[model samples]
Target: MDILQILILAIVQGAAELLPVSSSAHVIVAEKLMGLDPTAPAMTLLLVMLHTGTMFAVIAYFWRNWVETYFKSPHERRTNLIGIVTATVATGIVGLTLQYLIKHIVANGDPHFEIEQLFGNSKLMAAALAAGGVLIILSSRIKERSGVELSLKSSTLIGAVQGLCLPFRGFSRSGATISTGLVLGVSRRRAEEFSFALAVVLTPAVVAKELYRLVKHQGIAPGASFPSLIHMAAPGLLGMVFSFIAGLAALRWLSSWLESGKWYLFGGYCLVASLIVLWVN
Candidate 1:
């Protein structure tokens, strides 16, 4: 990819990743329009780097608040840890189960079938986007309830919803989790905080998975030379920097809209985006 394409992809990834608008969907559409293969190893590597950038953005934006809220007291810290652990475990279980089913059953027991193969399916992406959009819209319309904390039930539900997002490109993880929290009567701010915390916890595993796939596909065995890995990663480093900057801006935008009771606008945009994807494909 050229510098211009990288810039566009970085910007799209950064903006859509945090805005509950499904960054993967937008990035895939952009790649398609640019005549690029979204499933290529190089492209996937860049995409993973972009996600790493956003993951850092999440940590940067939420660190102070996390310290204040979860670290204020020992009891609070323990409670928060329990919630995070529970949610993460649920996410893993559900996500892995879905992945197994997709790979084995949907792919007709093809051992080599990778879930990334579905990433380029525009029709499937449209449906996932539409599902996420509807959930966001419905959650936004619900009356804001007070005094609800991140309990086990709420966290489990949120994580399960997030897991469903894992195999589907256009299913927004942040959107679905936050909406699930809202629908379960959790406060908006609390839901957003928990949602992003889950993201931070989930990102490292995803990044490692992508790196493994990239290295394996490049025919690099375990204990490969460092130079080869660096050469492969070099093209995506600049994209990561660009995406980091854009991701911070997008997070600010998301927070503002969410606080201003304009969250439903993102849902509207997603609904329109789903149609656009369907039309384009």
Candidate 2:
């Protein structure tokens, strides 16, 4: 891809990543429009790099708040740590289990089947978008309780919902997790914070997996030339920088809407977006 295309993709990914919208869905659609193969090794690697950029954006935006809120006291730190760890463990288990089940079901007797093959299914994306939209809307209607703390049970529930988002492109991870938290009576701001924290923790593993897939597909064995690896990663590295800037702006926008009780507007947008995707595809 050229720099111009990369820039456009970066902006789309960065903005949508922080919004309660599905960045993957938007990026995949952009790829399709650009006549690029969304499942190609290069494209997948670029997508992960974009995710990394937004991951950093999350850290940059939330670090101070995290320190003030979760790190101010020993008891607060311990509580937050336990919640994050438990949620992460739950996410791993559910995500892996679902991936295995889906692969087996789709593969039947073929061992070569990969879940990436389904990433371009527009119909599936539409369905997932609708589901996420419904969840967000329902959760938005619930009353926000004050002084609500993150509990193990609520965190696990949020993580489980996040796992469901893993294989479905249009199922927004933030939307699902934050909504799950709200449904469990967590406040909006806290829910948003914890959801993004989980994202920062999850992104590195995703990036590594994509990198491995790219290298394996390219027949780059262990001890491959550093120059060749760098050459392959160069375009994505440029995209990452652009994405980081866009991500910060998007996060600001998202935060404003969330704090102003406009969270349900995103749900409405998602529903409309689902129809648009269906129509365009």
lDDT for each residue of candidate 1 in 1-281, tens digit (9 for 90 to 100): 88999999999998899889999899878988999987687788888999998898889999998999889999999988998999889998999999999988889989889998898788999999998999999989988888877788888888888899999999999999988988998988888889999999999999999989877887455786899779767768988888889989998998888778888988988899999999888
Candidate 1 Cα outliers beyond 4 Å, as residue runs: 219-228
lDDT of each: 0.89, 0.88
TM-score of each: 0.95, 0.95
For every model in order, what is the number of clashing pairs?
0, 0
Q: Return the clash pairs for model 1, or none.
A: none
Task: Give candidate 2 regions above 4 Å deviation.
Answer: 219-224
The TM-score measured for candidate 2 stands at 0.95
User: In model 2, how large is the Cα lDDT of residue 181?
Assistant: 93
Assess candidate 1 and give its TM-score to the true structure.
0.95
| Candidate 2 weakest ten by summed lDDT | 215-224
Compute the lDDT for candidate 2. 0.88
